[model samples]
Target chain A: MTLATPPVGEPRHRRGSPRGTGAFDRSRRRLYLPFVVPALVLYLAFVIGPTLAALWISFHRWDGVSDMRWNGLDNYSALFDDPTFRTALANTLIILVVAGAAIFAISFVLTMIVREMRGRSFIRSVLFFPHIVSAIVLSIVWGFIFEHNGTVNTILSTVFGTEPIPWLNADNLFLMILIGTVWISTGLYVTIILAAVDRIPRYFYEEALLAGANAYQRLRFVTLPLSWDVISVAAIFWTISSLKIFEFIYAFGGTTNDMPPPAVWNSALFVYGESFGGRSPSYLFGYASASAILMLVLFTALIVVLRRLLRRDSIEF
Target chain B: MQMRYRRRRVRAAALTLTVTLGLFGAACSADDSGGGSAQQFTYWSMWQEKEPQAKVLAKALADFEKESGIKVKVEWQGRDNVTKLLAALRTDDVPDLIDQQYFTVSNAIVKNDQFKDLSDVHDMEIPGESKTVRQVIPEKYDQFTTTANGAQFLIPYEVIGYSIWYDAKTLPDVADNPPKTWQEFADVLARSKASGRNPIALDGDIAGYAEFWTATALSRTLGPGGFYKLVSDKQASGWNNPGVRNALAAIASLAKQKYFIPGYDSSKFPAIQTKWAQNQADFLYMGSWAPTETGTLAAPGFKYRSFNFPTFGSDESLPASVIGFAVPKSADHAEAAQKFIAHFLHKERLSKISSEANNLTPRSDVEVPEQLEDVNELLQEKKLSKITDGVLGDFSDFDKKVFQPLNLQLMTGKITPDEFIDQITTGQRDFWAGHRS
Candidate 1:
């Protein structure tokens, strides 16, 4: 496998090769196996290896300590009936669709506004700052902003003479989490969409304006179509990242140092809660693995569907 | 010819380097796997290195090594101690001694049969003391310390329990003569409200804390082990018990009357608990760790005091949780680990748990810390039960999915007692139906 590796590793070395010469192309091809083989080996060992192992584990009843007992399909059946897992799966989908929609909608608007605004780069940087901050820090700050006597309620009570709202109560907690997630996530997507928007030559907007294009027309025809590829990639990125969001919601149990209520759990939190998290670690490795594998299959299919829907022909400027 | 030869040599070198690096990476990933010598058993504690409990235990570990002339290797793994140990269980590198809350050990290690039965340790005489290990820790603690089949998998060290914690300076009337029944408890809340103070300070965001109201009330109504039985029934028939409805109604009344601090349902955990410590509210149903957790933020003159969960009907079962040491069955230095357990159980050594860590120890002879005096007296009473009657450990996923959410709804007045019963009944039924193999 190593012997036939490609010269994809050293483009500079291959750049000097004559374009149509068989000898140079053959030599470059000779390096292919060695370069690609190592990465393929590492990927197999790290990523594909554990994933297969998890698939195998999903069929058994293992506490992660004792010998694994084969219990074919029981864990999967149990997951379907497990209300917490259902809630988690539903929460994951809600974040993917609802929060995803809000983030893109707001980010596109922000991109359009900032594209024409003064100091656009500075505004973009200011907006992108939250993405760079740790989710733990962001969630804590969010908790402080929404707690009953928190910043929002304090202002409401003091200025508006209103009762302090229970923004973090069970009825409203997941909503607050979704809004915070959108607030933190919008900045990164906006920056991506904006960077793509900026790459479009300014003449496109000018030409559209001369043709009597309204703001929406300029956005639909000139901005979005030009940035469609980045938006598609960003959508996929958000889908995966949203599923992996455990730390932010987990930190809501702050200072008390327990997991947040199961009512608010997403798929990642469900996996952790069943396996290694919580005061009494369930260590239901087999069951947790089953849930994890189910989520992986569901999301993989969703991504495929998304790619198919978002596929667009590239426009040459 | 020269160019081809050089290229071949370069390829060979690259291949060699890749194989060498791969082998090196594989070697680095392997844990340092071995059980240490008998003279130097390893220890992993559930306390962080800087925690007061770790400090006290560190001193004891150091002293034990000096006296026994056996080196002690200790790691302060904090709350993840058991987790790390579980990951290391199949490896030869498993720690010789580890400690965590009893049920945590019970649910994780004991159930797996990875733990060594410590029944012999009960008979081992304490270092420089006449009493055996069994004599030092009271028999009453066996409710928490012993497993269902009577296997003592862990040796007792610290005792943790839950109660209605309050500031003595703020409610000296209740502190002087604490309420014993549910009606008296209601009167106390009403009187506190009449005096213009929020009667209960709860961090409702912590569903576990919120569920304490139902857990204790159910325990009082259904008698010892009643709550666990109710939640764990295979048929889910126990949820229909009149006692369960009564327990729900009692807490529902508190929610309807608005006894909790304003917006308690939305306050982040430890925030409302901190306010309770600051004497902003009158009472908090919490664990014995309340004082230590809130100590730095407490009001200047805040006096920590507690009373048992006000009884419903005639039962007076008190909830107790234990934290102590256990040895793995695979431990190479099992004898040495057992020796350390006996050494730590000595009154002189265990008293430091109270004095330095400000925690309650299982040793009846050890002088209880002032902060834990109320809790200690409560544990000493005749009737005792395990935390949440051990439901939270045995059926933890059920607790997380079924019990906590519904109980929270009941506590927040989002649902009535009847709805709580109805929802929990279906939830438990579905849980067992799916779980039955």
Candidate 2:
């Protein structure tokens, strides 16, 4: 007992020897480079390469047929002056902030209600079915349901004796699109958050319940705290996916076989409307590329800010 | 454990085998087209295989091949044929013959100087007829056939244009004496509204269709080629032109009167037009294709007829859209393609465009389809102008970005005529400034 001894708390192998600089560690490290280099090369070639190319192309004026001419910042500067582009940018942000807020709120409520419900799996599947269907199909069906003479109006007329409403008109079109985005996207986030919530030990909820915590208090303390990481990831996921939502809104043109009006267009549609779309193709590759670059930069910054704001220390159950 | 390993191996092997076979099949089916042969020319048609136009063309092509001892390989590409053709232009396997709306070909192929000079094509005699290609097609269509470079880039075939359509059975007075002036047309609309019927059926969702009110007005106020000058003015001074204000007033007056059917702005395309075809509305300003498109949906005994846009000036500039063929500058078998154009231009062959396809042919001698007779007569009676003053072909983006939105507001009663002018001027100035470099 009196004899000097190595500290019991200390790891024996790490006492004098380097932790990760050993011959075996060095060899294992060498294996990672070979394993990752191929994937790195592919990612750089396809993703990074195109991103740089788009940036480069954004500075020039090109119709995609003739040689590109340099017009530094003109394409980007022109975007602000463009009313359609402004509307598109505004619509995109509204979808991101407004629709996103709605989707998360509804998803959480659904998850909380479904958590203790009977036949939860079947209910979850029913909620998730719209997410699995094609956006084009969903948009078409949604449009038909809210059309002037469609289901909602028909019901209102017969039941309440209300006059038909113009749901798909210009003033209301963007609002309908926002509502649609929420309806279509909520289920996915619900499934994800529910999965994350399910991972928490059941004992935590039982403990909260035993402590005289109400349902809301239990969700606020036990459920939400545990699901923060997934919720954050889902928020970031929605930010990215929402920007790429084209088919749903594009299909809402509703048999006109034309792009929807500029008033309702989002950034995704802005890119398409400026190039390779409509009966008369614009082919404004440079301008469209510029808009694409702006969208990318703005969203990338948003994701970074979002990540910082949502960061939390992982809690051990 | 050995059995499990064997089963896993079998599964992996099956997947590998299936992937290999899939890759092979994809490679085999990649492309079947070959380089042009000595006496064969390839054609990429804009008609779908099952369409009436394609049927007529198929029969004509077969007969041409039998007669000339030259084969024509055709791909039945649909409406997006020009888009496909443009992509193929970069490759070695370019189609020898291509066809599309004249303005479409003008904007894409002709604008880029990719079309062969077809001024000689006009003089080329039809295969079994004494008349030349130019002789068969009306001289008036010559306005849209040539490019700015003075090259006859397109050979006119099908002629389409905007007209004020109506059911003759419902509106006998309109059918008997079609309105020839803007005042008279407005009177007709007022009268129709008073009789407890909606006057006009507009698919307000279609900007082009909605813009008809303004475009026709401009065509009337600004005489021949005035609309083009108004649109293409680099200084953006065209909006100040009195004619622009005049055109705006016409549409503004219509919107103010609520002459359009209720909920017209929100009603989807084909819905409003189909209702008009079913005689729910008295009039619809649409293209010549209106009748053929709505023939099935039309109420029984619906006599489809149309009148030219009512005049505001002495010179009546009627809108005409030509759908035709063009040979690419780099075509492999240009001679055969040119020869086929001549053979197909024959009266007998061209007549099928009207008889079978329910379309108007540039050859006035061809018997007019029942639905298209009124428009054909109007084209002959009025001074023909390129549809939308050919501005859609040259400044399509400007129209979409700057003009169409403002035009929509003007037609929808969202903005006053003066507000539209002011806003359009600012929009045009901004647009050109960005594009000037």
Candidate 3:
């Protein structure tokens, strides 16, 4: 019933105020009644309700189908012992740093490149092409490119004149996935930084240039600080996206069957495999859900840490 | 004229947006939901709904509608039916009749109570077959669909078997004919490699491949009860069981000798099937149902054929085996569902489906279509095996979780046959304890 509502507009505004429940005020309530209830209900039912349900469901031993049995703390206990889950958590961390650092560094460089270029629009479009491609599809291409006897091998064999390095072997499968994830996601951050940079006054950059500030000085003093708000937001998106990275890892490394060589399964894939009975004698929905909850905690902590560390001095350009 | 042109442009843009949104919405609406008329009963099926058997089903319903004035609507379950069906069941939107894979229905039945039993209505006639329904269905497959309380709700449907496939060009070069003994099989691989070809296009990571290495071969060679002594009874373990160790070692030996295509140690193993079909390999192991046209042997100017897995040694006797289907207790429309299922896999409908959709039939009485008769002839002549009997839960889940890691151990040469048994017994006991009903 609550999901029947939309998420905007207000008689919700008036109802919160106490003294407005009278005859003249009642007309405003009546005017806004139809619009407010639906939106409020929709938010309450879908967004708020499910988050709470998922939180509650994390404690139970249910495989999404069967009866949910109470197993308090057991799920959490199992997580520390799950090597694959530990591997997954480590991989998630590696991905977050690799993808986040790459996105931030690439976008910052590209932003400066575009600001100083005459063909800025064309350059921006070229840089932003990856954002237009779905991460899953890009992973497929990445898999083929990095697969044994695939594109990278062909190139390596021809140029380097060496034996074909196994791109998707146990040693490098996760790294290959990280490259694919970063490449597919970097362009969006560039777009975000560009939008923020466009808001800054052009005079500040001109003044910095006139004062004999070199390109690097102009960047450090002017563009970087002015674009802090957008950069922080984009970086936050990156951290969270990397932590929540499932589709590309799942699609490229394979969601089912095409697993990373043994002992190399990442946390999401590990939790997913154990939960889905891909493992023998598998029964750890509660453990998986707990690991997922642990992941959320890690994500929040990392975001807070990164935000504090990178919370830059905002320039009022 | 200018105003008219502007209006046309606006209309074209609106149409484009609408079409794009429509396509997206349609994609999201890919959940399988069967619809029925006032007099009609709806049926939902897994696998290819576009096949002629499905069309025949719709026609049967149409025939009933014409005579008895009842209509029928059918829907195809998606490849993602596990996710979709759970959502549908939660909504209590089960169709009047559903032709689900016995495994899908079974997985739901034990874990979730969503099926209806139809033992009383099991005698319903199929279009062509004369055998009683009981003879056609296997008990172990029936066991899969049974409840923990030992209730028989689901009926067996079609049984499919996996086999060894090769291009005819590679086969004669490896051996005079396909090898019957496991020793000869190893020799074939060696000869293939000697002839500068890898022997098999094996996808080591594929779950079915694990079973092909472990359960299918082990059970078929050892028999149902022998497999039980090994898996359930825990009597058969280690290098003592030649089939188990030999299969794993055989695969590892192949890997070591580079008898497999290059880079198989990684996940890129199956991606080399084009080369396998290109006659770069002498043998490839897969299901008998997979024909040359669409499978790994699918290549132009390539001739595809198959034989049963080779025997282990001079002492070993390998009999035939299979993977069969059964009805689940949780199926909502068991009586009507069984009738529809019977009609669907009935000899006439089975032939139609095999012809149109390239599926294998469980019933031998059904005439094979001219196109797929070669595949059928191979199954009959060589006595190609199945994995239906013995072991716990087809080792379907067991193979991936236990046997694979153990095989990797074999590949690394870390574990001997005795150690392999210790590994399986030690690890899989916990698994079997938790999983077995």
Please give the interface root mean square deviation for model 2, in Å.
5.0
DockQ of candidate 2 against the true complex = 0.29
What's the residue-level lDDT of B45 in candidate 1? Answer: 88
Return the TM-score for chain B, candidate 2: 0.92
Ranking by TM-score: 1, 2, 3
Query: Candidate 3's residue-wise lDDT over B97-141, tens digit each?
Result: 544444445544445565555555445655456765655553534
Write down the TM-score of every candidate: 0.94, 0.90, 0.78
Q: Per-residue lDDT for B64 in model 1?
A: 93
Comparison by DockQ, 1 against 3, better one: 1
After aligning candidate 1 to the native by TM-score, how far in Å is the CA of B115 from where it should be? 1.0
Per-model clash counts, in order, read 8, 0, 26
Better of 1 and 2 by TM-score: 1
Give the range of the ten consecutive residues with the poorest summed lDDT in model 2 chain B: B7-16
Tens-digit per-residue lDDT, A246-304, candidate 2 = 99898886353477887788999999888767777777889999999999999999999
Q: How do the candidates score on chain B by TM-score?
A: 0.95, 0.92, 0.71
Off by over 4 Å in 3: A1-37, A158-162, A202-218, A255-287, B1-39, B51-70, B111-113, B127-131, B135-154, B173-176, B204-207, B214-247, B265-270, B292-301, B313-333, B369-437
lDDT of each: 0.86, 0.84, 0.59
